[model samples]
Every structure is written in structure tokens, then in C-alpha cells.
Target: MQKIIVGVLVATFSVNVLAWGQLGHRVTGAIAQQHLTAQAQAVVTALLPNEDLAEASTYPDEMRSSPEEFWQKEAGPFHYVTVPEGQTYAQVGAPEQGDGISALKMFTATMKDSKASQADKQLALRFIVHIIGDLHQPLHAGNGTDRGGNDVKVNFFWQDSNLHRVWDSELLGQRELSYTEWTARLNRKISQQDISAWSDIDPQVWVSESVKIRDEIYPQEEKISWDYLYNHLPQVQERLKMGGIRIATYLNALFK
Candidate 1:
């Protein structure tokens, strides 16, 4: 089975190590940047003058290779959460290692701190931008047994890959779209009412959303192909769209 989309690829950094991969995150960033309010946009520009959300979206994932202690240790859990099959994220609660929900709250506060240095705030903003996007991919809030599907191996379009890799990049990468093209392709209609409907900055709520979709992401067969792709591609699109809208919502509220 396989899925669908439009456009050519723009090369980026390592894809296998991150949630939603590079293109997905950049698409979320591009959509979020477009929807940001004037005040929010000003704040974003102030922090990451050269890079908009599209470019800044991949910063955290890129840091996976960093020799810095913070990136090596503190940033891993911030990229995903583990909400088991039946229980809600609340019942299980985030562990002491910290999760996307808590990490996001931490980053949000850092960005909002007036006493925080420009360097610190910039770093926090990038983290927030990236993590919010990460939390939307259903596999990020994994079922706990499969290491977010990393252990669940499969052949995607005849290549060796796992469930997590399929969702992260295989699907998006197969589209052959640049981040800008992916952004434009996924940036759907966002009316004022739609914006109002999309509000709610809680990361826990975001986790719940992921859990619901996570249920639909799997197949009984390890040999998934085109049919499997067609069924779940819509979920990928929806998640990316929601990720962008919600990121913009949080930043707008934060800066407003």
C-alpha cells in the first residue's frame, strides 16, 4: 500500500531521528508563521531574525547531534510522550524525566521571562516551535511497547523501514516536496471560526488528540504497502495542519 501528495524534495538534515521528520516540522512552522498575529510575528522575528518558523522548526531535531550536554540529555523526552493504549495522558501523568507537555510548559515560561537573555529566549522559542509540532504526530505519543513504532519494522515502498520512520519521513519524503511546497500543500482553509475552534494551548490535550489518531496508524500485517498509505495519509495531513494552527495559537496568546 501507498499514499499521495505533490511536489519535489528539498534536502535537509538527518530524518530518521526526529518526530515528523524535517519537512513535516517545517511545514508546520510555515503554516504557523503565516497565521501569526502582528505582535506574535514581531516577537518571532525578534528572536529568530534570520529564520522564520519553517527554518527554525527543525532546530531541535538538528541538535540531536550536538556535543552539548543539554541537547544530549535534556532534550530527548521533549520530542515525545508515552501515553499507553487505554489510559489518558492525565492518569499516567508525565514522568520525572519530563515529557513534551512539561517540557513545553518549561520552554513557554523561558520564552516569556523578561529577565531572560536574548540568547536564552531565542533558544526557548525554537524549542517551543519544534516541540509543539512534534507533539502532533501520533506516534510521538506512542503505545509504549514499540518504542513509538521504531521496533515495528516494515517495508515502505520496498525499502527497509519501521512504523515510526514511515510516519516520520517515509510518507512525507515519498511526496518529493520541498518544505515550502509541503507547507503550501497542507495550509488549508483557516477561517476566523476555524481559528476559534482550534484554540487550547494545553499539551496534555494535544497528547489526547495524538492518542486518538495513534489507534488508526497501524496495520496487522508487517508488510504494509500502498493501501495502508492511502488510509493514513489523511491523518498525516490533518496532524500537520493542526500542529501549525495550534503553534500559532499558543505563540499568539503568549505574545498578545
Candidate 2:
């Protein structure tokens, strides 16, 4: 049954953990190298190990019986996951907010489930961590239909892919920078208060914030391709930076 859904989902639109890693490398780099609380730094560090794993851990089938079931697995050590919509927190029992909130909830739940296998819980935790950052991305939250624009086909700087996939991996990976190199460039301009104040917050707020950003992302057009890229790459980078900083803030609160 799970396989069926995954298959269907894959057919409709497929996003793997590698997508997360590619985005995270840039986002995480932006989060680190900034002055933050020790707790926040630690949370970012914990997420660091899982960064590259996003490349291979696209195993949503193993996590739960359905998308809702996947939400139930939200516990902690890491805090976020890509939850399918139409499922509530009470129904799913995981983190109830957006990617970060949902991921955080899953992370907390995994820590409490002694009956769960270590590997199962850890995989869940890794997603929780990764997804929080994903949620902060306005495009990841999407426009309530395309699973965050994954289905919105377009030519991203001439590459043929959907907007969601473009945002998921292509744009960030385009420059061929390591996670550290990307963050280094971003962190240079961050202020001390931005680092301190950005730490410690709820993921729900982040989700709401992204939803607002979503409207600005998509215009009423059949295609959002290279032309859109020329116009919006700056917005794209800004959102990625926002996601990284916001993710660092949420994790700091959790660990602290």
C-alpha cells in the first residue's frame, strides 16, 4: 500500500532527499559561520551529518503507511519533514506545522518511541532536520496544489524541470559550490542581532511566512522558465538564506 502511494507520488512528482541536500548545503552554509547560540550551533551541526544523506534517503515508504502515517513518525534530534497536506497533527500525531514544525514534531516523537527501531527513528529524525530547512523555502510551501511547485514545469536557466525541482536542487547546485562555500558568502553580511534574534522560534510561524512568500513567487503564467530565472533568482537566494537562518533559529530553541 505504501509502495503504491510512493509510486503514484513519484509518477506525479518526485523529490528525493538529494534535493534536500543540494538545497541544504547552500542554506546550512548560510546558517553556520554566523554568530549564534551554542545550542543553535549544535543543532546545525547535528543536521550537518545528514546533509549529504539527503542524496539517498528518499525512503518515505519505510517511514509510514501513508503520508499521514509519515507525519506520525515526527520525533527529534532533527526537526522537520515534507508532510503531505490534508492531514492534521491530531490525525498524524507529528509536528503539526509546516516543514520545520512538522519535522520538529517528528523529531520529538521519535525520541519518545522506545519501541521504534534505532534506524527507523534516526531516519525520521534526519528528515525532520532536513525538512525544517525545506519549509523555510517559500517555494517548498508552494501554492497549495503542486506540492510546492514540483509540478510546475519550466526551464530553469534553460534546464527542463518543474519550478519545485528547480528550487529543490538545480538553482542552488548551479554554482557548484560546497555547502560551506555557499554559506561563507552569505554569512559575511549577517548582523550579530540577526544571528541572535533569528534563533529560537516556532516552525509554524515560518510556514505562515513562506505561504505569504508563495504568492509573490508564482505569477499567472503557463511557464516559469529561464525568463523567470533572470527576474527571480535574487528572490530565490534571499528565500534560501531566510530558510537557513530560520532553521538555525528553530533548532537552537529545540536543543536549548
Name the regions of candidate 1 deviating beyond 4 angstroms: 1-17
lDDT of 2 by residue, 141-183 (tens): 4333565576677765555776666666666677787766666
Q: What is the TM-score of each predicted model, taking all chains together?
A: 0.91, 0.63
lDDT of 1 by residue, 12-124 (tens): 11123488888899999999999999999998998888888888889988878898988766677778877879999989877666778888889888987889999989888
Among all windows of ten consecutive residues in candidate 1, which has the lowest summed lDDT? 4-13
- Quote model 2's TM-score: 0.63
What Cα-based lDDT does every candidate model obtain?
0.82, 0.52
Q: What is the number of residue pairs that collide in model 1?
A: 6
The number of the candidate with the highest TM-score is: 1
Q: Give the 10-residue window scoring lowest on summed lDDT in candidate 2.
A: 74-83
Candidate 1 lDDT at 166 equals 93
